[model samples]
Target: MVATGKKLSLDLRVIELHTQTKLAGYIKLLQNNMRKLFFGSKINGVMALYC
Candidate 1:
């Protein structure tokens, strides 16, 4: 029973780390998308000026 408890604790730690990594990746993706959207709108506005 003690061994099982130890294994469960280790598994929880691994899961926590994985979740953090995933969350970080998701945040980065959102930042990148926002940057792209900001720049895209700027470019569109410039094109509209010419059109």
Candidate 2:
């Protein structure tokens, strides 16, 4: 019984780790997209001013 419990705990830990990794990947993607959007907007604004 104790061995089974330990196995279950390990499985849960692996699942948690995978979930954390996936969430981190998504966060990084979102951050990159946001950075691009802000940078593009700034460039566009500058171009409009120059025109």
Who wins the TM-score comparison?
A: 2
**Which segments of model 2 are wrong by more than 4 Å?**
none
Query: How would you encode candidate 1's per-residue C-alpha lDDT over 1-51 as one tens digit per residue?
Result: 999999999999999999999999999999999999999999999999999
Question: What residue runs in model 1 are displaced by over 4 Å at the alpha carbon?
Answer: none
Instruction: Return the TM-score for candidate 2, rounded to 2 decimals.
Output: 0.88
List TM-scores for all candidates, in order. Answer: 0.84, 0.88
Worst 10 residues of 1 by lDDT: 42-51
| Candidate 2 local lDDT, 9-51, one digit each (tens) | 9999999999999999999999999999999999999999999
Report the Cα lDDT for residue 25, model 2: 100
Query: lDDT, candidate 1, residue 2?
Result: 100
